[model samples]
Target: MAVTKAKKAPTEGAPVFFIMLRNMLIGLVSTVATTLMGAAAKGDWLIMLIYLRGKDGPDKALPSFLAPSTNGTAEHSVVDEFLEGYGMKHLHLFILMGVAGSFIIYYPVGGFWHWYYYVKRRDQAHEWKCQPNKFLTKENEAHAVMMGSFNMMLGGTLSGTIACYIVNGGYSRLYFSIWDYNIAYTVLSTMFVFMLNEFTVYWSHRIMHMPVLYKKIHKWHHRYIQPTAFTASAMHPFEFLLVQCLMAAPIFIFPLYAGSYVGVLLWTYYYGMKDHSGIIGESQWPWQQDVMFHDDHHLYFHVNFGMNTKFIDMMYGTVRKKDREYSEDIFYGFGREKTETKAQ
Candidate 1:
């Protein structure tokens, strides 16, 4: 419930412990739901959704997937036996999670919001858009959707597998009940993952805006001055690799739980989409510098380069002022806005 203004800061932020507590609560909810969704007990009749068995330790989790929803090939689908015979059934889970995260979460949510606020509630135009009339074309929309969808799936699959192997020691991380898993572990691990992810995106975003890199790599992402939901994840695969891949960095150092990792990325995908939707208004985690901050990044590229928090951008003196001017570049030519006429 806070809106930041330039380098000046919020009077105060919710305590760090409270943020960690909230992450723990989110982990608890998401873990239980994903655990059940991936759960299968022979003859539950829902076996069709999850034909394969679990892989992690008895009280652990895995990136497993739902069995094929088809009935063929000796009464079993090709996918059914392929995973079992290869002993890589967990691959199915990773692929399924990736596809679901990409299509289900990333696709429809942002699209719906854009239509909801922009089309249906057009009267709130000024309230919503930081840079009105600078819409993405059908071509840009299609490119963004296709590229973003593919990257979301790819990033999820790779990161899930890596995290699964490391966190579970090549096993699952599911427990029969919530009491079995330690809230301290889940909460601390989730907070680590969240903070690490923020650090990754903040630096990656600033690096992309460098002059030599901008025209070569990040320019395509800046095509839509007034981006919508579909444009949330739109970026060059190289850029996605630079920024999104860091979500897995915590796993290499910290012992992040498998379920906790998934929860963190789910937030990243969902919230990051909203961040790019170009909608400027009150949000649930306004203190996180959600909408206006990111919209300002797209509208006035010279400022607000940090993601999820403005601390880094403010420190770098890149936070945008209402009447900020974009005239020159310093280190790597990061400043490239309206010296003449920028995004309006």
Candidate 2:
């Protein structure tokens, strides 16, 4: 009998087919969860209202708790108007469609970068494995599905509910529309949200790195050191809420002239997913410099802390200059020694 040596797994090339497949599955489950959650919540609310009405005659029931008043009459109570205007039939469908449309459009455009550019370029020298690796096992797939669904559902539900309250006050015009294409408005709003949310993410992310917090709130996300499409949303519920609130705060505070608000929100989601996509590729055009800054931070922590831009990092000398390369491994303390060794 002859003894044989074990062969090492291939480490190169884009997991194109599998990556896309995973993305599709994650997107599908996310869409379903979002739709079901919204519908169920609305249904439960309706049921509760009906029960209350039965217990206390319609006239005696609290008017504030009802839906939006359609009689061109302003109700004194907030609940009444909320109930009257809340048409579960169309609203639920609209929400489901909107969320589904968002993932469909966003993932293809922004999500494709990882497979097309980053993975293809980075893994050129490594061997290609046809089947899923240990990291991409069935368990990982399930985890990713749960993470994606929870992230989207939680973020969308919270933001949409808040928007419901604000929009009901005659601010429905803020929702994004096809006809409204104001470049200036879009740019300004995007920048504002990016700037504000960056702080929120940075602080929350930093906290997650802390020993105590990392053990609980943030550990699940970091479980995927080399993240895949599904790893994007694999975070704890508390982490999700904190980050989503930070992301949504600007939108709530700022009043928009047109429906560009929706565009801004969508843009945030698009970029947020891309940041976690584990891609590091250059954009096509000259002005669109290769800013894999955020994803790089996730891959090689402490280098790219800033979310959307490098301005603040650069200003504070925290920006990891490309010339000063860093390693994916090694927890060499912070500053010069860490940076220098990693760069080497």
Candidate 3:
């Protein structure tokens, strides 16, 4: 049976500030954990490859994460030089690591976020859910996870291939760390990357909504019309490619430091999950729109293709303001729902 809206219920427990804090921590920890896992997996794969070649340690200067030393000199795997250096010098190794790393990181991160919000917080689940009465049935949930997991793998492969190519081309500046560059460059580059991403995402997403593309490629994502944190990365391969292309587009123009690149990756994961989180919260900032932006896209299917930000959407006139009382969908079969409706 099609689910319908339930009666609005009162918000309980913590104040808006506390709820936001708790939710933000969950997201932050999840993203950082995923990134760390990816790094560990990448290192492991490189180690295996080196061991296969009868090498045990890196043969060259290492990145910041691996080169940390006490006396201002790069410290490295003194006993495992052959193991680390060969892969660092080879493009294929990076690509291999990237593919493995992506899967290792995203799948669990998505699942954990889903369980934390949807199952663990059962009492506040509906209140937080953006789309009421729109939970994925078991079959659909499985499909979403499967597709999302595949997309994460694909993203890893593509990103890894790109990293290999860039590093091999002798662009050392492209492989910098947060401390390698001055604060001004890091801050400015971060902002620029954000702007570039918004511009590309806004246009690519809007174009995909065209009927022909939507029917063939984007439909898989819309299956989770009421999106969960897991659904953020869940999408048709073509759609993931399209989005990742835009995301990686800036690399052609900018030589991003390693820390900056990691920062972008983390921010992408964070915002993507937050936007898909069904919960309503205090705006806090004038520029920050409620979840309704993307939530409406899933619920109504026609507007709000923008990401978390509205700069480009505002300029292009594609933003769709969600109805005040009807922002989220029904969570359970019961006739009542919890509303966090704030004055628009």
Task: Report the C-alpha lDDT of model 3 over 1-344, residue by residue, as the tens digit.
Answer: 99997755454655899878888997777557644443332222222222232122222222334333434333233422443354334344455556665566555655675677777875675677666566778787788778766766676666655554444343333434466678888789888887677767777887777667777877778788777756776788888877777666665676665556556655555556667766655444576666767777787665666775765667765555443232223211111222443322
Better of 1 and 2 by lDDT: 1
User: Candidate 2 vs candidate 3: which has greater lDDT?
Assistant: 3
- Candidate 1 lowest-lDDT run of ten: 39-48
The TM-scores of all predictions, comma-separated, are 0.65, 0.54, 0.66
Candidate 3 clash total?
16
Give per-model CA RMSD. 11.6, 12.6, 12.1
User: How much is the lDDT of residue 288 in candidate 3?
Assistant: 60
lDDT of 1 by residue, 120-191 (tens): 876767766766656667788788778766666656565445433432334333332334568897787678
lDDT: which candidate is best?
3
Better of 1 and 3 by TM-score: 3
Measured with C-alpha atoms, the lDDT of residue 141 in candidate 1 is 75
**Cα lDDT tens digits for candidate 2, 125-218:** 2332211232355676578657766666655455444433343342332334433656676677666665566666655676566666767676
Model 1, runs deviating above 4 Å = 1-65, 68-87, 90-97, 156-189, 283-286, 327-344
Candidate 2's TM-score: 0.54
Off by over 4 Å in 3: 1-92, 170-186, 255-258, 281-285, 322-344
